[model samples]
Target: MFGRIGRTSVKHPWLTILAWVVAAFALVALAPALKSTTDQADFLPSHYESVQVGKVQERAFPEQDQPASIAVFWRDDNGPLTDGDKADVAKVTESLDKAGFNLVKKIETSPEAVSPNGKIALASVVASVKDPYDEKLLESVKELRKKAAPLLEGTSLKMGLTGSAADALDSQESSGDTDAMIMMATLVLIIVLLGVIFRSPLIALLPVLIIGVVFMVANGLIATAAEVFGLEADASVSAILIVVLFGVGTDYILFLLFRYREALREGQAPKQAMSDAVANVGETIASAAGAVIVAFLALLLSSLGMLRAMGPALAISVAVTLIAALTLVPAIFSLLGEKAFWPSKAWRKQPKHTLGKRIGDLTARRPGVVAGVSGGVLAVLAAGVLTFHPTFDAGSSLPDDLESVVAMEKLQSGFPAGQTDPTWVVLEKTSDGKLEQAEVEAFEKKLAASGFGEVSPGVIGAGGDVAQFAVLLKEKPSSDAAMELVSGKLRDAAHDAAPEGSRALVGGLTAVFADIQTAVNRDYSLVFPIAGLAIMVILGLLLRSVVAPWYLMLAVGLGFGAALGSTVWLFQGLQGKDGLLFTLPVIVYLFVVAIGTDYNILMVARLREEVRRGQNSADAVRHSITHSASTIGAAAIILAGTFGVLLLAKNSMLQQMGFAVAFGILLTAFVMALLLVPAVTKLIGPRAWWPGIKSDTARPAEPGPLLTEAPAGDRASV
Candidate 1:
């Protein structure tokens, strides 16, 4: 099947290239732009309490939809506000409301909102829209900020905005700016690294040029797929898509090019060598891509809608990359052949005692010791997973100097950290009719006395039967202490202290994060195992052996633990961070483990090929490592380098993700694939393919044919 694909692509290179170009342009021309949402409720199913609160708010108190944002006022002199300063707060609030801010209904300040110390006052700005995270509302907050600066010019109190709209505006700006940085860094890394590896400006630029087309096509397909399937994604997908497409695309191209160069060195005609390259490594690339696609598709089982959408979106990208790898890559390269590596005469002859050969010889000579040491190193690093702490504070992972974060910190100076974003408890009539003021006030007092903090009535709706109370916490909303307060005492008090005929529900950003924590924990138990099992199935099908897939997954599992553990050690232990991003484990498992499987598949497949071509187990290990090393090494370095570009971002999440992934790829390719997998397979002997006997007790190929080859005609194809 692979031979047929190679032959057809070789025979009709121009047509194949034209077909890809046409399809890419067609998709780009017709597909609508991809859309993403920032609404917290949108990320989870409707059943969660956080989501239910949003629905309840819309249905019950439509007027008190989320505050578009909050304006916090304090004396710029860092002292208590005089009565005149409070008057200025009211004056500025009224002026900002009248400033013609789009999407803002009206700004309101009250005596009750003033701190007891008289140093800080807050005015809640409500948006007219039900969805406060709407971009227009963020713009409204931006406009309101411009208006506030002028309004405060003669006042003693200074003002800053904090809350949903303000945070959204800041996040939009940060991510938007960082997107360009990440893309430029990625492209530069690919070009410079490829330039160094191939020593050809053309080859360095080729994958970038090709992947540019793949990016458009993949994005268009992903957008189309989302539209057709009703998949809702987050804004982060675009930047992520750029890295995945370029990184994976380059890896596939390098795999084929390395094989092509090998064929060229064996003296095959340019066109024939290209065909032979495709025929040999094509299945490996396909299987590698298949692993990634299926692993991503497994996110469909995720309870979170974000992953459900993201999983399929990324899966579509890898599928497109795979297609282009087998079809488009071969077609274009067939025409260039040896000229692809032009100006580098090294392609004409293989190098002697290459790093690959030395490593291969070491593993072949002492498989047991190599396996023991490599496996032991992975084991030692895996211990750090014991100290893993998951942080749901996505905002804290942002650059500290970002406006929203800075504003939030400034707001905290004169008020409770949670003042800008308070948790809400709602009491609703299980049936209908108005709630007695006595019962409502009684519930409020009960909540305050329970140490959940005092509550102020924010909205009374459903003819006074449904009521919402804003309860300010003492701690920052993103802190673990705050999560404990909300998920523990506040919720228990709310649920326990409801009026006779009413029920109470806690709702806020903190509650949302708490639920997200629960959702993530649930996903870890289900998603990781499911993705692992699915990948194992892919390996089993590709290798046609049950036993091999098990050990391969174990090696990849060890690699995953080591990757995550190292990140925890570096970021949490060494850097003294409170915790790493909660999503780190999931990200590491999917990209690192899944892609690691690709390297494992390539190496193991090569090992099997060497064994079948009449080499003993140890010699097959040597031969496989010697021949496939350059391909895996080049691909790993490029892929790892691409991810490393994320470190250029000031945001800690991207930095951590960059380091973990890049390190994991190198660990998988160099240590696990080269040392551990080969050593273990050599130790396992013929039974590694067992349940199915794929290798025979054939004579070993002369000690190092691949490392120090026989003549061109006599040597077998790599």
Candidate 2:
């Protein structure tokens, strides 16, 4: 099937290229922009307690809305506020409220808003819409900051905005041109690496051109899918997509080019060599991509809407890159023919692989020693998994200099750390009748005495069937301590002290983070096994041997552990970070396990091919490694380099992710695929192919030398 595709592409290169161009243009012009949501509740199912609280707030306590942003006021001299300062703050609040900014519903303050120490005061900015991250709502936050500056010119008070809306605006502004920066870095890295390896400007620039088009098409399709299906893409999706397309896209292209060059040196015509290249590596590429797609699609089982949406989106991206690899890449290269290697005659003959030969010879001679050492290295790194910690603090990813982050730190000095976004404990009469006043007061007293934080007096809803008690935790809302309190003691206390006729539901930012932790834990259990099983099935089908798939997947699993463990060591141990991004494990799992599988498939397929050519087990291992090592090494470096660029980002989350994925890919290529897999297969011998192949005995018609001529300065024979 792939041979026929290669033949058609080579036969009519212009037509194939034209089709891609037209499709890309059409999609870009017609597709809608992808939309994302920042609301934590949007990512959770309605059944979760936090989500349920949002629904109840809308229906029962509509008028008692949470502040979208808080305007924190402090004395310029860092002293306690005097009467004149307090009066100026009130005037500024009133003036800003009357300014009529879009989405600004009201700005409210009172004597109680002042801190007990009189060092700080607050004005809560409530929004007309519930989504604090809404663009217009964020605009209101910006406008409020601007208006407040002039009003405070003569006063001793200084104001800075903090809270959901202001934080969102600051985060967006601080990450200025991050997407463009990643794109430029990835392109430059690819071009430089390719140029150094191939010594051909054309070869280096070819992937950029091809993948640039793939980028346009993939993004258009993702946007279109989101619009039609109403999927909630996260803000991070596009940045991730850039890496996936360039990294994986370049990988598939290199696979084809390597095989194409190999066939050419073996004396086939350029067009015929291209056809053979497609036929030889097509199954391997397809199987590899299939594994990645299946693993990504497994995210559909995730309880969080973000993972669910990300799964199909990434799956779609891999699928597109696969098509381009088999079709568009071949079409263009086939036309260029020998000129693709212009300015360098390296493609004309087989080059000596000094490092490849030594590694291959070692594995061929002592499979057990090689396997033991490689496996042992992975095991040692895997120990770091025990120290893994997860954090849900998105604010930590923002620059400390950001207004919201700075103000938040200042606010903590005068208020409870969780006062910015307090947890709400709701009590509702189950029978839709008014709750007894005594019961309401009793519930508030219980929550206050629970010792989690201060609890406000219960505010009854207009319907009288529902009431809310805000608990200001002593820790930051997204902190581990706050989450534990909300998910454990506070929840237990609320349920235990609810009025006899009422039920208690705990909901707020901390409650939301606690619920997310639950959903992620559930995802870990369900998604990992399903994805691993699915990839194993693909390997089994590709190799036609159940035995090969098992060990192959095991190696990939070990690689994942090593990658994650190394990340833990770097960030949690060496860097002294308390925890990694909560989603880091899932990100590392999918990228390392799925994409890493590609290298495994390539090596195993080559080993299988050499075996089919009637080479002995040792000979096959040596021959396969000698031929496949350069391709895998080059491709891995490019992919890893692209991900490594993320370390340059200001956001710590991006930096951690960048390092994990980059290091993981290198480990997969050098250790798992290059060393571990070949050694194990050498030890397993012909039985590894049992139930699929008859024997490892040399076939009379398939005669070949085990070792080809060594390049200059290398051993004459293996």
Candidate 3:
């Protein structure tokens, strides 16, 4: 199948190129933009209690809504507020309230909103009915900041905004800049690395230009699919898509280009070399991509809508990249031929001393020693996994310098820590009529008296059958303590004490985070096994061996563990952070396990190819590693370097993901794929393909002595 694709692409290069151009352009022009939401409730099914509670609040309390943002004020002199400072804060609040800005529903300030110490005061700004991620809300936040800056100039007091609206505003501004930063970093990484390795400007820039089109095409198709299927993309998918395309896209291209170059040095014509390149490595690339696609599609099993949407979106991207690597990438290189490496001229001469040769010789000569050392490094790092702590504190993850985080800290100093984002307990008379006021008050008292903290008087909902009470805790909303209260003590108290014929539901940011934790834990159990099983199936099919896939996957798994454990050790143990972000494990699995699988597949496939030749298992291991080393090394560095750029992002989650994935890819290439996999293959021999192949006996080596030559007898076909 890949041979035919290569032949057709080579036969009609211009036509193939033209088709891609047209498809990419039309898709870019016609497809709708993808839409995403910031509300955690929006990403969950209605079955979860947090989601159900959100529905009740939306339906029952349409008049007085949750505040979109909160402004905390204090004296700049760092003392108790004087009458003058208090008057200035009141004046600024009144001014902003009367401005009547779009999306600004109302602003509320009262004596009760002031802190008991008289050092701080609070104002709540509510937005009109709209999506939490809506641009209008962000605009209103910006406008509010603009107007308040001048209003507070003459005062002794200062104000800082915190909560959802402020976060949305910050995320919106940063994501745009983040995209640009990632793109620039990715481009520079690719160009510099490719330039250094190939010593050709065309080689450095070709993949960039090619993958840029892939990005446009993938995004357009994904956007179109989202529209057709009503998929809810995560708000950050665009940024992620950027890295995935460049990282994986470059990987596939490297697979082909290296083979193409090696074939050229072996004296094959441009067309024949291109054909052989695609034919040889095509299955390996396809299998690697297939593994990733299946893993991503496994997210369909995730209870979280964010993963469901992201899973397919990313699968589409890999599918597009795979096709381009097989068809479009080959066509262009086929046409460029030997001229593609014009200035380098190195393709004509194989260097006598190469690192690939050295590593290959070491592995081939001392398989046991190499495997032992590589496996030991992973085992030591994997020890850190036992100490992993998942951080639920969103505020803590935000840069400490961010306004929302800063303002939140200021608010904690003056008010009940959780008051900035209170948990609302809703009671509904489940059987049908108006809720008895006595029952509602009793429920409120039960919540407050249970030791969680203050509870506001009940506010009747639109229907008399429902009532709402705001509960504030001593812990910050995003803290583990707050989530435990919401998920354990507070929820248990509410459910157990509800009046007859009524039910109590806990809602609010803390409850929502707790519910998110539940969903993620469920995914860890369900999604990981499913994805791992699916990838194993892909490998089994690609390798024609059930045995090879198991240990290959095992190696990849170890690599992922080491990557994750190292991240936890760095951020939590060494840095003394309260915890790493809760969602990082999932990110690491997707990038490290799924993506790192690519390196393993390439190495193992080449090992099998060498075995099919006349060489003994040990020689095959040496020969395969020698030949595949340059390709894997350069690709790993490029992909890892691009992800490493994520460390430059200000967001803690991005930084964690960047480090985990980058380090993981390098570990897979240099350690697992390079040393561990080949060494194990040498030990397992022909039986590793048990039930698939009949013989493991060595064939006599062929006549070729070229440094870059493939093993002698016609290599086995996929």
* The candidate that achieves the highest lDDT relative to the unseen native structure: 2
For candidate 3, what is the TM-score?
A: 0.95
Spell out the clash pairs found in candidate 1. Answer: none
Worst 10 residues of 1 by lDDT: 707-716
Q: Tell me the alpha-carbon RMSD of every candidate.
A: 3.7, 3.5, 3.3
Q: What are the clash counts of all predictions, listed in order? A: 0, 0, 1
lDDT of 2 by residue, 1-718 (tens): 7767778888888999999999899999999988987777889998899888877777887776689899999998989999888888889889988999898889988988988888999999988898889998888788788888889897888899999899889877776677887788889988997788778899999999999899889989999988888898987788889888888888888777776776777788888888777776777788889999999999999999999999989999999999999889888988888899899886665577778889999999999999999999998898898899999987888889888998998799899988789898899899766988888998888888889888999988888888888989999998898898899988888899987778999999899999999999999999999999999899888877889998988898899999999999999999898899999889898778888888888888878777777788899899878877877887788878878877877778778998999999999999998899999999999888777666778754234321111111111111
Model 3 poorest 10 in a row by lDDT: 709-718
| All candidates in order of lDDT, best leading | 2, 3, 1
For residue 535, model 2's alpha carbon misses the true position, in angstroms, by 0.7
By the TM-score metric, which is better: model 2 or model 3? 3
Could you tell me the lDDT of residue 464 within candidate 3? 93
Local error of candidate 2 at residue 428 (angstroms): 1.8
TM-score sort, best first: 3, 2, 1
Which tens-of-lDDT digit does each residue in 1-718 have in candidate 1?
7777888998999999999899889999999878898775689887777777777787887655457678888888879889899899998888887887778888998988877677778898888886778877888887787777877887787787877777777766765576687778778877887777678888889898899989989989999988988888787788778878877888788777777777877789988887777777777788888889888888888889888899999999999998888888888888987788889775565555366678889999999999999999888877789999888666787777765776677667666777867888888888666888788888888887887665775467767887788887888887888887898888988899997788899888888888888888898888888888988887777666888888998999899999999888899889888888888887787668877677888888777666656878888887778777766776677778777877776678778888999898888888899899999998898898776555658844434222111111112122
Could you say which candidate leads in TM-score? Answer: 3
**Lowest summed lDDT window (length 10), candidate 2:** 709-718
Quote each prediction's TM-score: 0.92, 0.94, 0.95
CA lDDT, candidate 1, residue 569: 88
lDDT of 1: 0.80
**CA shift at 219, candidate 1, in angstroms?**
1.2
TM value for model 1: 0.92
